[model samples]
Target: MYIDASLFMGMHAAVPGTRQACASFFAEHLRDRVWMTYEEVGRCDDVVWALPRDTQDAYYPFMDVLHSTMPVKRVPYTEDAWKTAADLPGRGVLSLRERLLMATVIASDSRLVTVNPRLLNLADQGLPVAAPENSDGRHGAFPEPLAGLYRTSLALEIDHARI
Candidate 1:
């Protein structure tokens, strides 16, 4: 399971009761299965570059947790990934970060566990997308119905902790 920045933020923010809850969730549910890309981790670090030096200290611990807990795999931007992203029909709508993430997933041949569903609809362009069934609050697993594949914010928050 490859996680993006949004999910990484959730883990970093786990505090007080949330910290214990997140720890139990990760140990029981995701420890061995979850992994993140170097690109994703770097994006988190990039946040520091945008913040003032005085504020960077406050965010460093969260960033440190992300760096230490999530196994980072360094994946380079490849021709095939760019080609796949270029082929996406609504490419114009995606931000640079989203494009890179889509491209990385394409290059890795790994499923993206994101809340964004519109990206999946662009699979016709060659990026294979699938949301986990457990991601849906009621389903506990992805259903064949397809309509409920993407998650709502509350479910995403829970799933983020699990990841």
Candidate 2:
């Protein structure tokens, strides 16, 4: 799974439940050995947004421990990856960071592991979505009741949201 920045942020959340949820999610899925961009892995390193305390001293050490502990395969932002990011399938709506992340996943031919709703929308288009909440994972299957799913509200919404 291409691990997202949000999942990493969740691991360090002040809320015990959120922290545990992230941890458990990783524990269950990371045996496949996850991949993440250096940007994603480092997104929280210098930021003060979610930390309980933000200081230069605190920040450096936090980054150190996180780097040493996590077994993520940090993918480089290569030239082709950048080109792919420039024009990913879903645009206008998806953020740059999300595009870059997905680009790397596409280049690597791996499933994206994200909780971002925008990406989840992509999952609904057949990319596949999974987390602890869904009892493993669910295929973005064609509903039997749809008769022809192209007429469903979700399909219409996904079409409308397309770049």
Candidate 3:
């Protein structure tokens, strides 16, 4: 599953529960490995770099350790993904970052996991997406309902392109 920036930001949240939830999400997905696009990763890095110098110094090591210890799988932002981002089927609704992220998701054939209402709306429209929420407030596993949704969405995109 693809990890979105929101969830990624949650990992560093000051709220203990939020941090733990993000940690639990990573632990649960360790075996399968969590995927993230290069752009998203850079965005996270930028968040860190934008912090006060002392904070950056303090968190840099922590961030390094986390990256080294986590089960993260980096997804390259390839030309195909760039092209897809340029013409993503969001009808001018999605922001550049969202389109880039979605394009990478499509290029990698991975389901996106996010809390963004806009992206979730796309998921509601049948794109493969899963929220990291369950009744107990822990990270939920990938939903079976989203299994082939990405392919279906792609088919629709293709059909629409033909028109």
Better of 1 and 3 by lDDT: 3
Q: Candidate 3's residue-wise lDDT over 121-156, tens digit each? A: 888677777766544864543232232331222111
> Clash totals for all models, in order?
3, 0, 0
For model 1, the superposed segments whose C-alpha errors exceed 4 Å read 10-30, 33-38, 52-55, 116-163
Q: Which pairs of residues clash in candidate 1, taking residues 3 or more apart in a chain or in different chains?
A: 133-141, 133-142, 134-141
Question: Per-prediction TM-score, please?
Answer: 0.53, 0.62, 0.70
lDDT by candidate, in order shown: 0.49, 0.56, 0.63
Q: Which is the leading candidate under lDDT? A: 3
- Cα distance off (Å), candidate 1, residue 55: 4.9
Rank the candidate models, highest TM-score first: 3, 2, 1
TM for candidate 3 is 0.70
Q: lDDT for model 1, please.
A: 0.49
lDDT (C-alpha) at residue 72 in model 3: 84
